[model samples]
Target: MSENNRYTLITGGTEGIGLELSRLFAKDKHNLIIVARNKERLEKVKKEVEKEFNIVARILSIDLSVNNSCEEIYRFVEKNNFVVDNLINNAGIGSFGSFHELDMEKEEKLIEINIRSLTKLTNYFLKKMIDEKTGGILNVASTAAFLAGPKMNIYYASKAYVLSLTEAIHEEVKDYGIRVSCLCPGAVQTAFQNKAGIMKNDKTKGLMMSPKEVARIAYRDFKKGKVIIIPGFKNKLLVLGNKLASRSLGRKIVMHSNKSK
Candidate 1:
């Protein structure tokens, strides 16, 4: 596909790694469609991207946590005649306390957004890309995916699913010339900490990385079709350690770190 005809569609693109990825894509002169629940922030980002890269930036404001969100997004894309060349399933949520302690509604919303919606959107776009014979997919998982997190159980499980799903799809679509990458970033510095209610502990802050650095690494690794892209050296070691450590030991470490604050 010609560069002019291709456009990237990024979810949760108003902030964090998603926003940084949008900026990177814009720098490469690719048209962009950024989806987020915040219309105002999305508009602001669109303007900034257009100003900086001289590329078209389309905004779609919709809550991915809603049950029917995937269908709604699909319909909107069909109605607007937007063809996506790259799909970034970056929207997700996390709960900080014990799963049972959190409100049931909040827990369900987290699952809907982080798992169901991501899967639906990937399936939707993957079909289209397969038919077109060219495209890419990047799903944002987390280092939490490598182990069972005690305090953030549901979020960790959801990301584990993302990593598994992305890897499976990567193998399935390799022959279609479509690259699929799962990004497993550790403790990124963004609104995620506040949203996830992660305690303001020294360990968390010390391990935190800038969203721009994570995005840059993810984008580079993704383009090269890396199956799993962990952004930092520390994170890479953590992932490797998870593989070598006993499952019980890994879970204990996660629980300790989470409760340190």
Candidate 2:
């Protein structure tokens, strides 16, 4: 296939970091297959990017949290003959509150979106890329992966799994010329906070990074085949700080940070 024909597939590509990454990839002349739950938003993004970048922006409207949705995405690209040269597993959701008090259904869907679908999609595309002997996978994790979270328990745990899985795959696939990188970003100014039940007055407000900035840095580092891409310097420091401290201390810090002052 020609370089011009290669496509990048991004999940949750209608908003937040995923949306920013779409613009960056499109700016570089990469064709895109963006998957999101909202058909209206997806169509709007597709129209805008296709017109601005002069590249194809195919949109797939599907809820990744649903059963077999990942398989449906794989089939969509295959049927349309879209060669995904890069797969961005960027779809994720968070639920804040005590684990016991949280809605079980939401938590289940969170696991389905953040973990199962990501793993499934990665598995599907990684095989194709390996056969072609070229491709990249960028899994969006978070700094929360480094420490235990209190009120935001399941989300942190899910991100930790992403971090670990991506790191392991990065090592395993480097020999095959498949660049696998995990993007561990700090708090970003996006709908994620509100959706996660995080209040406006939260402490992370001071550290919030813009989605565009995060996506720019992420695209740069991922293209470099960096195994772990932490967007902000302060976020890097936070990860390092957690490592230097005891695990229990790190948990306590996260717990305290979870509270609004």
lDDT of each: 0.90, 0.91
Q: Evaluated with lDDT, which candidate comes out highest?
A: 2
Candidate 2 Cα lDDT to native: 0.91
Report the lDDT tens digits of candidate 2 across residue range 1-261.
Answer: 123557999999999999999999999899999999899999999998998988888888899889989888878888878789999999999888888899999999999999999999999999999999999999999998888999999999999999999999999989999999999999899999898777657556766899999999999999999999999989999999888999999988878878652
Error of 1 at 97 (Å): 1.3
Over the stretch 39-155, how does candidate 1's per-residue lDDT look in tens digits?
899999999999889998888889988778788878877887878889999988888888668888988999999999889999999999999999999999999999999999998
Q: Which residue runs does candidate 2 get wrong by more than 4 Å?
A: 1-5, 202-204
Question: What is the Å distance of residue 222 in model 2 from its true position?
Answer: 0.4
TM-score of 1: 0.96
Q: What are the models' TM-scores?
A: 0.96, 0.96
